[model samples]
Each structure stands twice: as structure tokens, then as C-alpha cells.
Target: MTSHVFRVGNGHDSHRLADGGPLVLGGISVPHNRHSVGHSDADVLLHAITDAILGAAAEGDIGEWFPDTAEVNRGRCSSEMLLEVWTTIQQHGYSIVNLDCTVFAQRPKLGSHKLKIRQHIAELLKIEITQIGLKAKTGEHVGPIGHEEAIAAHCAVLLQRTDSLV
Candidate 1:
């Protein structure tokens, strides 16, 4: 008999907003008055996705793979980070089943740019757009996100073993 296994992981990331006018999210730059502050591109959505994939494979989080303290990682692109994580897990015989993601920000309505962001993320993961779910929310004036002081993202991923060892 052949056995199959599934793994699920959830990840969250948040970054403080700054004076920058353009915000990068899910590999797409969206027009906004504030941007996320971080060592890298600070794409909260992509960071969360990377963590979810790594977590699902029992691998360490992004901090372990790409430490923010490293000068080499400064200004690094989040899409590239996500791609590298995906490659590592693929070599371990794991494939993404699906990913559901949410981004929280108070400004720059995401409805119009969601499809573009979803498509960009799908390309990074090498998965069909249909396999990814993207949602945007506001903090409802309750927290940093609501106050437009920060942005946050959450991601959940499902992965399955692709290689069967007989």
C-alpha cells in the first residue's frame, strides 16, 4: 500500500510604515503614502508566504534562512526570497497544494490590485493562480494597521509529499 501525507503551516509578518510613498506587497508595488520598514523590500505578504512554506516543510523560518541582520540581505527582494524557499522545499519532495493569504493595511484599497498581486505570487511559487487566495483587510481603526502606522500579513499553506519511497 502507498501512503500519502499532508502538512499545513501558518505564518504572520508585520512591518512598520514609513514616509515612503510606494509600498511593495506580494511582489507588486502599490501606490500608497506609506511603506513598510524592514531590512528587505518589506513585502509583508511575501514574507508570510515564505514562512508558511518553510514551516510546512519542517524547515526553519525566513529569519534562519535570510537573517535581516546580514548586510547582504539588505534591500533584498521578497519575491526572490519566496522563490528560494520554494526551491528548497521542492527538493525535499514537497509540493504546494494551496495557499491562502491576507494583508492588513488601512490605506490604498487593495481590491483593484489584488489580482495583480495574486498573479505575481503565483508566478513566484510556480503555481496556478487558482491555487492562491488573496485577501486584504483593515484594522478598523483598532491598532497600528488601522492607524496607518504599519502593515501586516498572514499566510496558510498546505503541502503534500510528492515522492513516494517504497
Candidate 2:
């Protein structure tokens, strides 16, 4: 029997930097230049990951599920939001096969944190670390990200139907 092969989905997220605490990406808070200001803790990596899984399953974006309008979501951590998205995808009979993500920043040197980020995401998605591809890029001194005033991420996911695992 042919496994139900469907599609690959892409997700992108961005947030501005704020001066207060260190920044958190991919669930691990890195001591960086500035933090992200948002209604939530604003872990941009997790936000992108959540979007990828949701998109792969043809579900709506994060805002559709966790609206900024809801007072409860205010000051919420992005990891928690991501967990909810993963649950929803699984319930809909979809499991992520692999995901490739890119993080754009201008400072703090992401080289030291890539491994931790991979481990964090793998743990969150219950997937092998090999299934995740993470890349970091500098904005080349251009745009908001180049000024170290913002960070953004893009994620693409390949999800397989749960029934096909057999």
C-alpha cells in the first residue's frame, strides 16, 4: 500500500528586540544583547516551529489558536504555546518527519547555542535531533535584524500521516 504522502509546510516568525532581559530562542534562553517584546515571552524559534507543525497539518497559524486578544495568553511562554500546537497536530493524525529552520540575527554569536537549540527542539517535538536542521544567518548590517533590534526565524516541516508509520 502507498503511504499517504501529502506536503511540506513553511512557517515564518519575527519579533522586535527590547531592553530588559536576555533573549530566549528554541526554548533555551541565551544571554544576548536584548530580549523580544511581545504579549508572550516571545521565543521566536518556538513560534516558528509551532507554525511549521500547524502549517504541515493544514491548521491555522499560532494567532488563530492563541490570540493576543486573550488575556490569558498575555505574557505566556512560547514553549507552552508550541506544545499545544504539537498536540493538536498529533491528534489530527499527523507527525512531523523532519524540519529545517533558519534563524536570523545580527549579534550574540549563535554558533555556541546551535546544539542546545537543536536538543531543545528535538525534545519538544519528540523527534530525533538528526531530523532537525538549524541554520543561523546574519542580516549583513541591514534591516532591523542587522541592527540587533530584532530576530526572525523560518521553518519548513515534513509531516507524515500517523497511519503510515505502520
Candidate 3:
């Protein structure tokens, strides 16, 4: 009989905003004049989720797995990266119990897009939508995020061991 052990991990990511039309977040494309700038698609939400899962599993961070120095990572899709991380964690006998995420932006209010974002993330993780909780925030005209120069995201995940403990 194995006892279940729970692990909690937290991750955060931020990226500068560049003039663009579509901004990707949590695997969903949102209509926006500015988009995140990074080596990949720069989906801040997905990147944070990936890091959270990896941290819970004691795996190295996303940078170790996908480095900007590698040309192969350029323009890569963030959803694919998140899916790979989820698959790896599942193989290690870890199952996600829940995830709480937050995104901060100064423009293009996200209230209308929250549900879609959650759905896309759930689909990518192959988990029920209820397991994911997402929130959107504004920078309140303070920092880079408030100035509309950047977008940021944070994620906290709870994982449970599914394998038997000897």
C-alpha cells in the first residue's frame, strides 16, 4: 500500500510587449494590439504553468529544457512545451490536483477571454477544466506591466503521487 504525497510548486514569467495583433495566453490567441516578445510564442501563462509542473516534479526549470540560445526554440509554440512537460510529469507518476494562475496586463481587459483560456489550458493538459483556476489583473499604472510594456503570469500547482510507495 502506497501513501499519496502531495507537492506544491509555484512559477512566474514576464515578457516585454511588442506591437502586434494577436497575443497568446494559456494556449489561446487573444485579440490585442501588443504581443509578448520572447524566443518562443511567449505565452506567459503557459510558460508559468510549465515551470510549475516541472518544479513540482523536481525537474529542472523550463530554461534548462528550452533555451533561447537554441535556434530550434525560436518561434516555438508554448502549448507544445506545456504538453511535453505534463506528459513527462505523468510518466513520473504525478497527477495534477489543481492549478491556480494569474495574469497581469495593463491593456485589453481579459474578463471576456478567461473562460476560453482555461479551456485551452485544460485541453493541453488533458485535464478537466475545473482543475484550473485563472485570474486576470491590471498593473494599476505602476511598473512595466502597468505601462503596457510587459505582460506577466504566475501559476501554483498541486500534484499528487499516483505510484505506490514501497
Per-residue lDDT value at 61 in model 3: 98
lDDT of 2: 0.87
Give stretches of model 3 more than 4 Å off: 1-4, 164-166
What is the per-residue lDDT of model 2 for residues 56-78, given as tens digits with 9 covering 90 to 100? 77788999999999999998988
lDDT of each: 0.90, 0.87, 0.91
Model 1 bad stretches (over 4 Å): 1-4, 164-166
* Arranged by lDDT, best first: 3, 1, 2
Question: Which segments of model 2 are wrong by more than 4 Å?
Answer: 1-3
Tell me how candidate 3 scores on lDDT. 0.91
lDDT of 1 by residue, 121-164 (tens): 88877889999999999999888899999999999999988764
Report the Cα lDDT for residue 109, model 1: 95
Query: lDDT per residue, candidate 3, 54-106, as tens digits?
Result: 98888989999999999999999999988888898898898889999999999
Clashes of 3: 1
- In model 2, pairs of residues that clash are none
Let me know the TM-score candidate 1 reaches against the reference structure: 0.95
